[model samples]
Target: MNMMSMSKLSLLSVLLIAHCSTAASDLPKDVFILAGQSNMAGRGGVSSGKWSGDVPPECKPDPSILRLNAKLSWEVAHEPLHSDIDVGKTCGVGPGMAFANEVRLRANESKIGVVGLVPCAVGGTKISDWEKGTRLYSELLRRAHVSVSGGGVIRAILWYQGESDTVKKEDAQAYQGKMKKFIMDLRSDLNNPSLLFVQVAIASGEGRFVDSVRKAQLGINLPFVKCVDAKGLRLKDDHLHLTTMSEVHLGIKLAHAFLTTLK
Candidate 1:
């Protein structure tokens, strides 16, 4: 009502607007990619330990891990998963949460938020299945490129495949070459030669291909790629899949590798 009061109100409003704008600019747009087979799809049921906590009420558990960016208030993608299941009623949690948590811990105060995880991994696919120009591989690359160019940095790629290729020893040996090619293509397309890749080693299971497949996975050594061992971690009842606890452990390991690479 008074001139003095009106002047004070205007100054307060200006300051409020400036603060909000600065906060928004400080939020990050980083992207973490998850790729691979059934394990990454999360076959284990959700655990009380991991799922229980201060998860925002709006959050839902599906194949993908979608969470709110605390700083920006935007929906940033975390984990990786395309479909829930063919039956259409069940979903499982993966290690993406643990990975994201670790990133936040390591990069405190950094203006970076995780974004959409473009999961193009088929359950029973081999390294050869991801060849360039193929329907599946092409789609994967397209999605990845879009995510990278759309104001999101490709922070890292989480890979957990190779079980299918181990049955054939010859295929195992060729896996390194195929994987190398795939990584090269990804780097070229994203225009980031230093893109980081974190891979999961196959855990022991009923399949005879476990050791062989893991060996092949390790053979593809790009400067940015590192392998995380999944052996000895608790697995699901199926003996082939990782339990929620194991998934979390795997995720932490992968996150540690990412931190190391950054250093």
Candidate 2:
């Protein structure tokens, strides 16, 4: 090749390398998917029995954490983290916001780019729904891909479900296998072998087969899969959902598990 052509090629290579490096540095590395049922979506401060309340201070919105909004776009994450997916009643505070805040505190947003939370929880859903090929499952996969498509990496999946499954003995009994399969499928599809899947054991007042679901949740014995206890947490007056304080505590537990096991 001519000297000028060779010089141009070398310059192009250097410029390409520089661009790639800058992009890599700019992209985020801590995108977490918070998916599950109502509790995972949060019903804190929303009274159903008799009393009403407001969102507490700890679980308020944060500027550092970004959530995938209903428009399928990223924006400042706030309460009702699953606003888009929560189609039933209005969305409320679940453990998601608190969890993201804790992660931000630990990850040090100033150093890393930011924490991106992908909320995909729907109220009153069953484990049967989130299996591999169902609509919810497909949507979760699609959202997860689109979420990290912006260049961030999927750090973990915060999963809290099975309340609906607990209604039927059969569903509760079958939860362990279904849940195990769901985790395997999620990891396989995401292509993250060591992905962190944190499952929050169900709280009380949800159903008659709560124990069965709890056993199944705890029974999901797999590497990189951790379980957090929510059996005795304070529940809302409805006796089905968690109170704001309990939700915050649950978020703390989830965050601790995520930060500790993630290596």
Candidate 3:
């Protein structure tokens, strides 16, 4: 090769290395996906088409914690984590921020890496909506991919859903199979057979089939899947969604599960 061409190749390699280093510094090393329905999107302090704008100390944002925005860009995460993603609902305090904060604190204590949360939950979505070919599922995978494109390692998926599926007995009865398939498909598509899952068992539901759905959620005996029961958490005035404090509590529980079980 000519001397000029060799010089150009060396310069290109140098610039590429610099760019990659910058990107690595910008992204977090540890990542988590938060996916589910309204409770996962968060209904805490949300009423009459508005959010109360209340944020608990445990759910506070930190410099070490980042969220993948709707634009697939990283930003400092805060409460109402799904405002842009869960557009249809009045987003409020959810377990996400609390989960991230708790995880960050615990990770920091252990000298672990930073935390990145991918919020992809849509309010009131059914399990059927997250089937492999569906829009919700596609979006979830898209966001997850974008999250890890910057070199972030996806540690686990934090799921809290199934309220929508409780409206009918058929949906409730089919919940187990659908949920297992959902987990399997996500793992397969993500190319991580051992991807950890921390799922919150439903505290409340739309209809009379809450127990059936909860039973199905707790019955999934996968290798890296762990279920955290939310049955005792406090619900809001609507008698359906969890209260703000309850979301914080759930976040703590999720962090505990992630630390003790999934680690």
Candidate 4:
């Protein structure tokens, strides 16, 4: 072979090797996207060993889903409390742990190992704040893409927002349209038309808009989307957040929804 031909061949061989290596890397067999407002962000106190048996060695808890050199690490999701904010004395755990545990349990027969959870929940965020094509949504999509690129296959999205939108009656009707658009955009961005969405209905409360938002969330009839009711679950004194026990209960409830999808 001539020098130029030999060089071209070598380059092609290098490219093929790189591609094979990436393909061979152990990507997450399952990936879960956890997103929403304050409740999803979690307000309950942190408990040690809450996820003792189920946590995969590779999975660690980090608030912010920070990516470095195409790899992800965890960081605290909240800091520099705003002036108007009230930091609940107790930190409430949300559904992420329970969901992971459920996956481990259900996958016991198959023994699927190391489920990756990408939690990007922010407190006090409105449904409108999750708008597609916006900076916030763009960041979310970017993180998701990176996670997938890093060998994580996104299997589902867990949403727990709507209180803010529900409080404003005028915005309730438009929620359905907004939610539909968000789902479509999410699927398109992720290139996964069948992405599973497990939504948590706003728990029963004093607010008038809660029921409206729940109804709207349930109204979206897209395939692979299901809503889990949190009405009966006991919430915190603020009448918004879930207590530790309630959080665990909520998590189990979410796990049930996820299992249903698997079936």
Please provide, for model 4 over 117-172, each residue's C-alpha lDDT reduced to its tens digit, 9 standing for 90 to 100. Answer: 66666666677888987765876787687667766678789888887786678777
Candidate scoring better on lDDT of 2 and 4? 2
Ranking by TM-score: 3, 2, 4, 1
Tens digits of per-residue lDDT for model 2 on 27-116?
446788989888888787675422243666767777667888767777777776765678776667788878877777777623435788
Better lDDT candidate (1, 2): 2
Q: Which residue pairs show backbone clashes in model 2?
A: 42-93, 42-94
What TM-score fits each model? 0.72, 0.85, 0.91, 0.74
What is the alpha-carbon lDDT for the whole of candidate 4? 0.66
For residue 49, what is the lDDT in candidate 3? 85
Residue 38 Cα positional deviation in candidate 3, in Å, after optimal superposition:
0.4
Candidate 3 per-residue lDDT, tens place, 129-247, comes to 99999999999999998988877788999999999999999999999999999999999999999999999899899999999999999999989999999999999888889999999
Total backbone clashes of model 4?
Answer: 6
Given candidate 4, what's the lDDT at residue 75?
A: 26
Quantify all predictions' global Cα lDDT against the true fold. 0.64, 0.82, 0.90, 0.66
Cα error, residue 168 of model 2, in Å, equals 1.5
